[model samples]
Target: MDNKTFSLQTDLALYCRTGLYEPQTSIQEHTFHYRRLVYNVIKDTLRRAFPMTRKLIGKRRWKKMVMHFFEYHKCQTPQVWKLPQEFSDYYQQVNFPFKKKFSFLVTLLQYEWLEIEVFMMEDLPIDEFSIEKKSQEDRIIPNPEIKILSTEYPVHLKNGKEITEEDKGQYFVSVHRDFYTKQIQFNDLSYPFVEIILKANEGCFSRKDFIELLAKYDSDREKIMKLYQDFEQFALQNTIFLGYQI
Candidate 1:
């Protein structure tokens, strides 16, 4: 075939493979078969990326959701890798009466996504340009890696459902990357305090500023100090506290 004819044929095949039921007048049965193969590839990709999501919805529903997604959305990005996020987004939009707890499922999936994203982050040597290190009176910068820090509520899901208000705001978690995997662990007082440090004004923070930030939150001096010490040690061990390069 000429280049033009080849390109036209390829595009037609891709369109059919993407679940758009185009008439075979311009294409052929082979085009539909090609489309089915594409659907399976996409489905398996989603399934691997979201085991929890699949399990949450169960096999039958999950299959239905994936099928519906394939039928409707033409994911045209060169970064085909982002298909998982798109799937998660679709899950959030679906209003299954049984899925009234989607709010929690969305959050959990988003959290898991962050964990994966962070784990993939390459270590940038701590910036030497300096954000003015907090002293006995300075603020701290929230690390970009810290996603979803809240004063109340550590978001979680139970059997794929979000726990309701009665159990809400009872815990906090700090999600961070460790080498190659995104890891999430419950936050101790120190983790939240690290969050507080990040929340400080955009410049250097002094020791006094740091101390005051803690005090503003009514973080007990003795207790927080102990927590801080323990936390610093933990960060060092985990390679997360990369000592200020400044």
Candidate 2:
């Protein structure tokens, strides 16, 4: 907080971020050496966080953004788990021209980062029930690691190099850490299925109940059976159902 401390920090930060610092004659060449080290560490961290975004933005612009982040964004959290989120937070308020040209960059970075985030999440146990539920009061608890995302760009599948405005669409997806394999998993989901999962987490609807609830609009048995089958396919994934509550 004092003038001397602030001046020292400001010089280091500027050198690391933009290579624009007054040469400290006291430290001599040692200052430049440390500056390079600091810059590379932060640059590598950003690269690891946003791999796809980095490739899309290319080397020049990606470095620039990272520098911008290093210069303007003061990271308060000491935990490394939060740095990527902080990087994304910096861009949330500042809409620069690159965003207009590459509208999918932020979404791509978010989607790419989510895989590692879920993989590192604390595991929650799920009870496996291979058979149909018999009671109306039984509840379905969604897997604690499951993250449901609705995005304008399909960042997971796309190559991230050639996305234009025409490639945009609403996508419903679920990403979870597999209970058995301990691997990150991804799946496509419909809006209805998402709604079912949300309501199930509240202990309101079982799969059978959801299908039957839809049956009210149309009494078609074939359609109801199809819906039931679809729900089964999704439920086959071990992470989808966290286990039923009595």
What is the alpha-carbon lDDT of model 2 when measured against the actual structure? 0.71
lDDT of 2 by residue, 4-96 (tens): 878887677667666676546476767777767866777777787787788888888887788788777777777776678778877767765
The whole-model lDDT of each prediction reads 0.56, 0.71
Cα-based RMSD of candidate 1: 5.3
lDDT value for model 1 = 0.56
Question: Alpha carbon lDDT of residue 157, candidate 2?
Answer: 66
The digit string of per-residue lDDT tens for model 1 on 63-84 reads 8788778776666554555777
TM-score of each candidate structure, all chains considered together = 0.69, 0.77
Distance from true position, residue 74, model 1, in Å?
3.4
Cα shift from native, residue 231, model 1 (Å): 2.6
